[model samples]
Target: MSTTWSAPGRVTLIGDHTDYNAGLSLPFGLDRRTSVTVRRADEPILRVRSDSPGAGPVSVPARVLELPEPPAVDGWAAYPIGMAWALAQAVPGAIGPFEATVTSDVPVGIGVSSSAALEMAVGTALAELFGLDLGPAELAAAGQRAENVAVGAPTGILDQTAVMFARRDHGVLIDFADLARRAVPLGLAAAGLGVLIIDSGTRHEHGTGGYGQRRAECAEATSVLGLTSLRELGVDDLDRVRPRLAPNVFRRVRHVVTENARTARVTELLDAGRAAEIGDLLTASHASMRDDFENSVPAIDAAVAAAVDAGALGARLFGGGFGGACLALVPTDRAEQLAAAITAGVVAGGHPDPVIRLAAAADGPRREPDPG
Candidate 1:
């Protein structure tokens, strides 16, 4: 028998670079997802194939899973292979050679966190196939390890945690200081509010130097501030530290500090059923990313401006930034109209035609019922 599993991509509604600094983040699982099908292989080799265009089949000795990282595998296949290594580490002897087919509607490199979705899908399949008793958070950690160690991307737990702990009609509010997660009721659909994701058609990879440089700057700031992480200070502490940090480092530090507060406020607003009031905070978060964090790209900025001008309640660039998707909160009735306006506005600004998706809070990862 074969098991098919899937995990949802995530949208970091607010709080971007703050995760690694042990700050707060609020993310919702997107309806877009990645799925994996797994069954035992006849040989002692881990085989893989993907339906994504231009991806080729990869095969490697199953014993490589025992290593800290699989050096033989690279590219998209490394995500699942790395996940298998992580799962094995969590529960020794729980994984073996398997052949899997991967598929997804989760667009890659557009900031929806398709990598986490892919990892979680493969992790869920391995756990079920081997009967491992891991919970959502544990699985999430393993996914993070896979990315950080196996895939070599220095990402925080936000993507994996958001993908695994997500709830329908709710967003996951995570405190990286302690990895505590609270389910905040989105109440968007009930309030006739919808989040429109406009793909700026500009791609970015977390493994790239730009992302690493941002992380490095945050670390330097943290060391200079004499704190372990930026979470050690609150917004009130920013003024006291500003004079000590370089202008650039200070801005980076400022973004993480203020973003945490914004994330907390948005969580409170959503918890109190004030989802409509979050537009200003979303826009503010974007401004912080653009000016302080220096993560927003010109195309994404154009898309965000168009979204706001087209009557979006509030709009901002979502994901790891640099270049990715922009999220705009809009009335459910006007979602398509807003999308059209964003498209026109983006083209007028001389950027590529953007891909627009209408999304809502969605369920987390799970094993799919066998279709056989």
Candidate 2:
């Protein structure tokens, strides 16, 4: 029997760097997704292949079963290997004797949570192939574990959770501390608007030093202020801790504090059906991330500027932002114009033509190959 699985990538609308701090986050599923097809084997070995030729076939012995240590092939196969290793812990004999092929449209390293999408797809495929009944939350957690332990990135749970559990056409407001979630209806696009993903084409690996440094800096700022997390701080509290922090730490804390407020405001705008008011907040968020968080690279800044110049309602650098992608809120009619302008700007800035796409919010992961 053949088992096919798919999971969507995620976009964080607000509350960046807050999940790990036991705070709230707002993430929505994207239209782009990854799919995996798997079949059972009897030899107790894992065989994997991908559509991309550079990512050659990889065969891992079931005896090894160690994550992050899969045979060093390259590209997308690492994602499946990592997922299998992580899933093995949940279902002791589940990972062995499987052959899988993976394919995806979620652009990697663009902060769209492509890694999490791949992990969820692989995990779901394995569960179907093995006749294991795993819940959506458990699957998301497993994917998060794979990314953290197997991929060596200490990321928060927002990306994985959103991809696995959010609903279509809604933004998931997640309380990370309590794991409570509410699906807030955000019919922004239905109101003659669309969310544009402007791929800067400047890759950012969360597993690398850049992301690690930001996490550490945020933690350091929290420690210096005697707060458990940056989430504990507010705009009013900045004055009290400003003297204790280095300039950079102070700036980082400022962004988090302000960003938390912005998230609340944006949510309110959506709830009130005042989508136009969010434009200013989006621009301010990008500015803070660039000037204070120091995450926006030149390409990202250019893309945001170009989108705004091209008549976008709002534009901001989305995701981790060291160098990935940005989001532009444009009228549905002007989406093409904004995309072309952003592409031209990137070319002018001596970068590759950005991959621009209009992304509609979508549902999270669910069981597909049910064995009835």
Give me the overall lDDT of model 2: 0.81
- Give the winner by TM-score: 1
lDDT of each: 0.90, 0.81
Candidate 1 accuracy as TM-score: 0.98
Model 1 C-alpha lDDT per residue in residues 137-170, reported as the tens digit of each score: 8999999998998889988889999999988889
TM-score list, all predictions: 0.98, 0.93
Model 1 residue 205 CA deviation (Å) reads 0.8
List, residue by residue over 1-372, the lDDT tens digit for candidate 2.
Answer: 868888999988777776776677788999988888888767877888888657778887766564444344345666787778777777776566788888778888899999988888888888877877788788888888778777778888888888887689899888776778888888786688889988888888887866788889989887777777777777899898899999998888888888888888888888888777788788888999999889889988988888888788788888877888899888988888778888998789888888899988888765455333
| Stretches of model 2 off by over 4 angstroms after superposition | 66-75, 366-372
